[model samples]
Target: MKYPTFEDVKKARETLKDVSTSHWVQDDLFTWKWWLLLAATFLPWVIWIKYRDKERTLEILCYGLLWAILASATDVIGGESLLWGYPDKLLPMVPPLFPADISVIPVSYMFIYQYTNTLKRYLVFSLLLSGFFSYIVEPIFIKLEMFALHNWAHTYSFIGFFILSLIPYYLIKKLTIKK
Candidate 1:
């Protein structure tokens, strides 16, 4: 079997990228699901802005940024590993479900961090939030044909969500500069 050359692999990748772009334009762009995804991408930030703690805005935003990084990275890994996928995309150039990674996950956890003042409260709320994300939101996405899971399950997602929310909070708590 002849292995493809680097240039050949690059050419194939470009072709696949074009296919994705074309598919997005033809099948995804401006569809109802696309509109929903667009709203999901932006609406949370609006809500967050309205509700986020004014005094702790910077700290909350930092936690959100960290969660976004972790969520986006994990989504990329999961997609690449064929553990899950998004059939419809708001933008083909991004991770399949960037609205979730970039907006929903971060915003939800940021709110939890902002509202939950004690470690016990944080843990309880975060666990509940993770369960909601894994069991409720994910199923809704699957029903809408937005997301699919292959080599994964809701339990795994629950664990991932829990860790993703917890790590950032602890890191922020540890690193915050006392005035």
Candidate 2:
């Protein structure tokens, strides 16, 4: 029933950090996942170049960073909890949450946010994208062995990703006037 103090949380994070960093660098350096990771790495910049002048810098920053933080946190918790995992990693120097969390999810949501003007439109588009990721892309990743689902499924991803994409839009609205 007791909550962890800041020091308790910090100590736990430090331990997890050391363990995860060691395992990643020593056991998972520069392999095939790294190559896929390299591609995942460049993909956001490519998308950014395409949309660079389309939106204000502050809008882009808030939208992208909020999603990135949420996605990374969830992916880490999911993986560390053994609910699911990205057994094949892209970046060995860091945590294994970046390929989708840092790159795909945020960028994908940013695109959805950029185009849609109304909540109705955003929700519809987000639902479609959620289905695409859950049903299409995730299954493809499963086939390619890029992703794994132990106790999780694409259906869960469908629901989770949809909510993930949608919540930030309203949050951003509350925070700013799209500037």
Candidate 3:
């Protein structure tokens, strides 16, 4: 019931760091999952860059950046709360699923935003995309042992992703200059 001293906290942190390093070396590094994560980290950005609307590049990028920030923050909260976690990491450090949070999610959402010119289309795409992520994508990650859900369910993810998509869309809609 007593608060731990800073020294104790440091010791715990060091222990975790050592364990993460060892686990990465023995189980995570150079594995097929790691290679897949590497590809996932870069490939979407490449495709997004090539196919994105050239005229609205900056506006679209702003939307993507907002999504990245929100996704990364939510990932951290989920991991910290033991709602979900990543088993295979590209690195031994924290924010284990950088590819999904920083690259894939944002880039994919950005495409949806750029392509959907109307609110109705955006909502429909958002709902479908959220379902795809929560049901199909998450199940695959669970099967692959890349992601684990301790106290969360696909329905929660579905709702969360759908709302996350709409937030950026609506905000960007207001922020973008009228033409």
Candidate 4:
């Protein structure tokens, strides 16, 4: 078995450094959409901090990370398929996935999971959240030219959002119930 050495990591970093400088087709910064991306990235942390004491912090964070990874997974496919895209990014240095996918969306799911305890409540809130993301949040980005839909529609988004929303909730429920 072979493991990468320290020098290998440094060389990899140097090779990828050009990404921050010019790898992307567009790196719109300080624009309105850029500002919104920044807000989307940090606002969730603020919201989470304000309500920190109400839930199991570790479990909630785990759920949030799960949602982030799920979002990233689907996001990679969507980006590759050209169904949708983010034109304005908060950080071009990172993967093209939105920062808010990791922060805002997942944190929002964590809150929903904490509040809605029953499967019935979970279903209701999940649908509401799915609609909120598909109809409201996605549209805001579409209007701002941050997210563009090519072959995608809000209908497709509702399906994805609804499924993704419930995943963390059920996962956490199963995990904590055993303990």
Q: TM-scores of all models?
A: 0.96, 0.79, 0.97, 0.81
lDDT string, candidate 2, 35-115, tens digits: 777788678868776776464767876888899998888888888788777656665445575877888778887888888
Clashing pairs in 4: none
Model 4 accuracy (lDDT, Cα): 0.80
- Cα lDDT computed for each candidate against the true fold: 0.94, 0.79, 0.94, 0.80
List clashing residue pairs in candidate 2: none
Q: What is the lDDT of residue 39 in candidate 4?
A: 82
User: In model 1, where is the ten-residue run with the lowest total lDDT?
Assistant: 170-179
| Residue range with the least summed lDDT across 10 consecutive positions in model 2 | 88-97
Relative to the unseen true structure, what is the C-alpha lDDT of residue 89 in candidate 2, on a scale of 0 to 100? 62
List residue ranges in candidate 4 displaced over 4 A.
Answer: 1-27
Q: What is the lDDT of residue 37 in candidate 1?
A: 92
